[model samples]
Structure formats: structure tokens, C-alpha cells
Target: MLAEYRQFVLPRQRGLHAEIIIIPTGELKVNIKEKNNSLKAEFDELYFHSAGKETELVCRDQLGTESVRWHLHLANDDARELAMLIESAEEEFEALMRDL
Candidate 1:
């Protein structure tokens, strides 16, 4: 998941830039078995940002919670186009999750 995200954002830069941060929540869940009655699981949060503004993308999932934020600093063009691109990416991510 992390790799995919990096690939998605790292290649596109026409004067725009983005950053991704992954933070571990350090929380775990336990399950009952018999001999091995517990399992280890980890949760994390993902933050995405561009320009300067921040936006939340994903916040609830089995792998952990994630959020994406985007900032747009438009110089000559309208910011709406950039906004649309971010929105499209968000939707694409959601669809990918569903497939998983």
C-alpha cells in the first residue's frame, strides 16, 4: 500500500509537490485460538499533503486507519483543476481498497 501510494504521487510534478507520512498507532488486537490464543496486529495512520492545505482520505480499515490531505498552491492556473485531480485520486484509492 505504501509503495503504491508513493508511486502514484512521486511522478507527477509540474511545479506541484506532495508528501506522505505513515505513523504507527502501536495498538494491537488479540484473538482466541487454543495453543496460540493470540495474534499480533498493528494499526497505522497515513497522512497525505500537497502545497499546504490538508485533507483526510481514509480513516477506517482492517489494516489500520489512514487519512490524506492535499494542499494546492496555484500560481497562474485555477486551483480547481488540482482539486479535481486530488479528488479523483482519492476515489481511485477507495476503489483499490474495495478490490483488496
Candidate 2:
């Protein structure tokens, strides 16, 4: 059988902290830990723009929803991996659109 998608989990330092995952279908699954509550957002849209050492992620769950911006500090390797994932997502989206 052929794999339809790829999945990856972002590495973190440890302990209870926020985590991010790239789903097989290309969406982002993010979990944030708060003082008394945890919040999870499955973003259908992800826009990544990088400048120098700073990377900005614009995420939205759906159309007309308020978008959230996240500024992430990533190592060189991490940044490269993220860029690849974004590219993969875009490619997949385009392919799906063409297929429909």
C-alpha cells in the first residue's frame, strides 16, 4: 500500500510545555499549556514567513476566523525542517485542488 501522507512531531526541551505537530494531511496540530487550562488548535491554514533568525507563523482554523500569529525561535536545522513541511503542505493542497 502507498502512504497518502506524512506526519511529524516537533521536538521540545522537556517537561510540560507547548508542542506542535504536522499532520499527515498537512495541517498543524498545536497544543499549548496554560496555568489552569490547556488549549489546542488544529489550524487549517498556516503561513510561514521568515526573516533572518525570526520566523512568523500565521495560523487560522477556518475562513472568517480571527487569525493568530506566532513568533517562533528555531535553530537553523529546525527552520529548514519547518520550511520543508510548509512546502509539502502547499504541494499537497495544490495536488488536491487539481484532482478535484
Model 2, runs deviating above 4 Å: 1-18, 32-44, 64-66, 69-77, 89-100
lDDT of 2 by residue, 27-100 (tens): 55555443233233343566566666545555655566775644334444555676676567667777877898
Give one digit per residue, the lDDT tens place, for model 1 in 17-86: 3332221223223222222333232223322334433232322344533423222233222233333444
* lDDT for 78 (candidate 2): 57
**Candidate 2 colliding pairs, count:** 0
TM-score for predicted model 2 compared with the true structure: 0.46
Global lDDT of each candidate: 0.33, 0.50
List residue ranges in candidate 1 displaced over 4 A. 1-77
Clashing pairs in 2: none
Alpha-carbon lDDT of model 2: 0.50
lDDT of 2 at 37: 31
Error (Å) of candidate 1 at residue 59 is 19
